[model samples]
Target: MAYQPPVRDHLFLLRDVLEIDRYSNLPAFADASMDVVEQIITEAAKFTGEVLAPLNSVGDKHGCTWNPDFTVTPPPGFKEAYKQLCEGGWTGLGSDPAYGGQGLPHVVNLSFSEMSSSANMAFSMYPGLAHGAYSAIHTGGTDEQKQTYLPKMVTGEWTGTMNLTEPQCGTDLGMLRTKAVPQADGSYRITGQKIWISAGEHDMSDNIVHLVLARIEGAPAGVKGISLFIVPKFFPNADGSVGARNEGVKCVGLEEKMGIHGNATCVMQYEDAVGYLIGEENSGLKLMFVMMNEARLGVGLQGVAQGEAAYQAARDFAKDRLQGRSLTGPKNPDGPADPIIVHPDVRRMLLDSRAVIEGGRAFLFWTALHGDLMHQHPDEAVRQKAGDYMGLLTPVLKGYLTDKGFKACVDGMQVHGGSGFTEHFPASQYLRDCRIALIYEGTNGIQALDLVGRKLASSGGRAVMSWFAEIDAFVEANSADEKLKPFIEGLAGAKAQQQDATMWLMQNGLANPDNAGAASTDYMHLFGLTGLAYMWALMAKVSLAKIAAGDTDPFYENKLVVGRYYLERVLPETAAHLAKLKTGSATMMALPAEAF
Candidate 1:
């Protein structure tokens, strides 16, 4: 079966629900009307569906191979696909127009990004990391850095990487050993061994710009001592052209990963490599997070893309492949078996995948909206509130979405029966790719801790309060829509339960911090479900409004149905989390070390 881009649904979201036309009227997006956005998405879809998607299995089968010469080649056709991406200008969609970008909306760019990842996740990670590097530099880099680096990066003439993790430190940066020594000039000499550097050392582009995190000599310990540096693979000349190769940076080896093998996950070593400071000293971690947050959401979208692709594959396969008879009745009397989709259990799996994937897409879009509001909204109070909402929801979007998205992929694979687990199918590959989303860009555990500890009390809880207000306002506005009544009511109940749970943790965390730590994981997931439920209701409301307006698309009807499914099945998990949160941390800590 061939892949068809869901451009209709995407356009519906943009033109109808989001009414991006209003935003397009603004000066920044003046050239990005619905017609232009539609055209762009259509072209991007063609590139993804026709060019890159065919190479997915090939990339998996023939992972990148690293030669002893310290050079790595991506799987067959991967480089050409990358060239297609660059030539098409898909890499610079949301970049600053002052340089080489189209200066498009982030959500619009994110739509294209989702398509690229769905087509080929392993290949997508290369430019994806580059986008993060570009964002960090574009946001904090000096004027010289911007003028010299932005054009090349935005034009896809060069690529970039984020270098933070090391052999000794993964999450706990307080124990990091990477060193940065200040030179007589303004530059610094950095020496560190960074492991699992995605797009770290690849032959995809002319140069690799690494945003490295290292400590200055004699700086205070912990994350505070960290500083960000711009370390390029090949030094850039004053004219912004490539220059002599910088010594000290080398790709010693690549990790043997379960999936995304087309991209090199290299062990990078830097010995006194020349680097320029990105931001203020002793604030490297702070600067690194600007990139990390973007990357985290990108990872979350990766999970959604994998699940969507897997679901599409499985659904098509089930319909085409004849299997067991339906339980209620046999419709295909002349055939050997009925379509597997007829079975209740099979439907359950597909529905679960459908519900989670669609809901996750909407959730990601809403999060992206907040991101745009944070950056584009002029009012300081509005920006602050938007930032708070983003902070409160980022963990949920990153952690819970990926967690369920992994399972959704697994279920999608399971829909293929025995073939799902075999190398002959892509389901297993989807599972492999989806699994890492949970672990990388800070583990779900770390994201959960951040949500409970830092974001919950930030700005005296103003952020969370504003989030509750949005949900409350939505419920109040849609109260009369009977189709949405149950979802609105059920989601409201879940939100109330979450507020109580959060209050419990906040009050008790002050005395026994373990309360927050122990409940953090569950609490984060619960909050994510509630947030997603709220998004689903919003989607359902918009979908219903479209239907009432005589919108002929069946996709809108399906949106409402899936929103109901989320309400009835997925959203109810809040009760479970509430139960766990109410149980407190005594039982969790009851098991001592000797008990094991």
Candidate 2:
């Protein structure tokens, strides 16, 4: 099945819901009028759907091959397709203009990435990781370092990867054993085996810039001793040309994975590989998080993108696949049986996926817009609030969206029944590919903990308070509008439950650490529900105004229907999460280790 980019939905979002032109004063937005934005997104859609979508199945079937020369070869058409991807210059859509990039808004770049990721997830990781690396260097690198690396990375001449996980450590940086010894020339010799390094080594780009995490020699113990290094596959000469190969770094092995096999997931061995320090020693985690945070957002989008592809597959299948008759009456009476679309149960599954796919996309854009505003906004207070919201919402965005997005994938497959289970269809690939998003860039469980353990209390809880206030203001302002009463009421109700849950945690969680740990996941889901409610409200508000003006577009009408379905069906999950979470850890922690 060909992947169709949701260009229309995004245009509605940028034009109607977000009113992006309202922020035209921002440097990037100044050039991003709706006309230009539409053109860029439309072109991106063509490239992704035409060039990239075709390779998704090929990438899955052939995967990548590890060779005797320590090089991993991409699937049959991957090399050529990657060349076209670079030639098209989609990788640097959101990069700084100073570095040979178009310098579009981050959300616009994210929208482009959503299509590419949907079409070819495995291949998209090549540029996705590079953009994350570009961001890390752009933010923390020295002027000389920036001039050396950013331009080519932005141009896709060089791809990048982040080396964080090792044999024994996944999320705990304190357990990392990678070592970096300082040389007389001020460069560090990085010696470590990094595992699960995506885009670690491939034959597509001229070079691979690795952002490695390692401990400096004789430094303090645990994570305090950690540092980030810039390790390239080949050294760059004084004139910015590719120089001698770095023999110390090699892709010693590749992991045969569940999905996304087209991209190389390598066991990268760095034995005395020359590395330049990023920022300062022991401050590496801070700098690396710039990429980590960005990657988490990107990963969340991966979940949504995969869900979208799956939903498209499932919806089409339900409409065409002959199944049992509808309970009410056979809509396709002339046929042997009604299409699955006539069955209410099948409708339930499709609606569930649609609610999440659309709501999740809006949540992603809302959070990303705050990211842009955090940097580009004029008012200090606005920037501070935007920054605070980014920190607080990132974990929820990651944890909740991926969890729901993966569920959407599962439902998508269920709608297909047996056909979805086989390799002949794309559902299996989407399910497998999306599964990893939950585990990488920090697990969903960890995201929940971060939300409850850290983010909730940051800035003396001002961020959460601000979120509450924002919702309250919206509800109050819209209560008088009768047509939007259901949306406003649902949103207000969800917000109240969220507030109550927060107060419960503050009251009980401090007394027992287990309470916080046990309630974390549920609370995270609750947070996600409220966030989506807020998003749906914003979308509904705009859609309602459009309809009131006598605009008869069915798009506006369908938006209200989906928004209502979400409020009635999906938003109610918050109550269950709240009820379950309030039970605390007593029963959950009662079982002894020996009992298991």
Candidate 3:
């Protein structure tokens, strides 16, 4: 089935639910009226569906080729699609106007991101990694560095990659051995290898800018001593034009992966590569996190995007594929058998996918709004609070969304039965592509640890407190409305369980950190369920209001049904997570290392 962008859903969320026009006071939203948003969404949908969707299968089938000259070529049509993406100015949709970006809101860019990802995930990564690199430079690069690279990157003439992993280290960056030796010209000579580097090399751009993390000689021995460097494939001259090749950088090999074969996962070798420092010395990890945080959110969006794509494929198939008759009776009497959608079990899978996908969409957009506020709000206190909220929620978004999104893909495949297991169907590819999201951008385990270890107590728990207060306010405001009682009560219960889990962690983890580690993953899921429940409640309230205003659109009605389904079937998982979390580290750590 061809991919279709969720344009209507985006329009509903931006205009009806988010009411983004209310933020006109912010300069970025000054021109982001509903009409403008609709236009952008429509154009984005057209571009992704018409231009990129057809290449999804082509990419998976042909994959990328590694040349003997240490260069890589993307799957056929990927370069052309990427060129179209650049020509459309989609790369810098949310970048700074000081460069060549359109200066739009991040949320707006997020809408297009979902469509692009759904249309073609492998193709999407090329630009997605570039955006992450662009953000790092825009945030931490010196003015001269920005003047040198930002414009070209913003214009899509050059692409970017993040280099952090090594052969021996994945999550444990402290063990990384990549080295950067300082030189007399104020540049550094980098020498080491980075593995699992996405968009590490390709023939689609004029140059590749690598944001590499390496330790300088004589610097500390651990993560604290690590520094970030701008290692370009080809060094640019004083006039901002491409110069001689940086002889030190080479794509030694490409990873033959289970999915996303279109984009190269390169094993990059740096042999005395010329590199420029970004930000303060010994503060590389801190600066790299700015990009990591952005990438985490984007990865979270990837989770939802894959789920959206899978759900659409499943829903369409269910409506047309003939199968056994409905359990109750024959719905399509004239046909050989009824469409599988008539079965309760089939509906269950579709609804499950739908609930998670839609709820995740709302949660992501809400978080994106906070990100916007965190960066652009005039009020210092608001910006700080927004930043705190973002810090607290980032892990939840990354960990929970990816886990559930992958499950949704599996469920989508199940809807296709034997066909889904074969290469002919897209379900298998969706499942394979989404599996990686759970592992990258800091594995979901690391995200769970970040949530439980750091973000939970951040700013003395002000962020969690603020999140609790907001949910409470929403429940209290809508509790009296009979139509919203189910959603309100469900959300309130989830929030209470989440709060209890937080208290349990604070009390138990203070005495033994193992308790926190044991319960981290469950706590992240609990927190995520509550977050989605809160989003559903808000969406339900909006749907109810729209319905009461005499609008009879099935769109609003379907939203109400889906929101109720989420509250009824999905939100209750928080209780189980909460219960498991309360068990602490006893049974979990009982087994010895060799027992497994």
Off by over 4 Å in 2: none
For each candidate, the alpha-carbon lDDT, in order, equals: 0.86, 0.92, 0.93
Q: Which model scores highest in lDDT?
A: 3
**lDDT measured at residue 545 in model 2 versus the true structure, 0 to 100:** 93
- Candidates ranked, most accurate by lDDT first: 3, 2, 1
For model 1, the superposed segments whose C-alpha errors exceed 4 Å read none
TM-score, prediction 3:
0.99
> lDDT per residue, candidate 2, 443-464, as tens digits?
9999999999999999899999
* C-alpha RMSD by candidate, in order: 1.4, 0.9, 0.8
Candidate 3: stretches off by over 4 Å: none
lDDT comparing candidate 1 with the true structure:
0.86
Better of 1 and 3 by lDDT: 3
Clashes of 3: 0
What's the TM-score of each model vs. the native?
0.98, 0.99, 0.99
Model 2, total clashes: 0
Ten contiguous residues minimizing lDDT sum, candidate 2: 85-94
Better of 1 and 2 by lDDT: 2
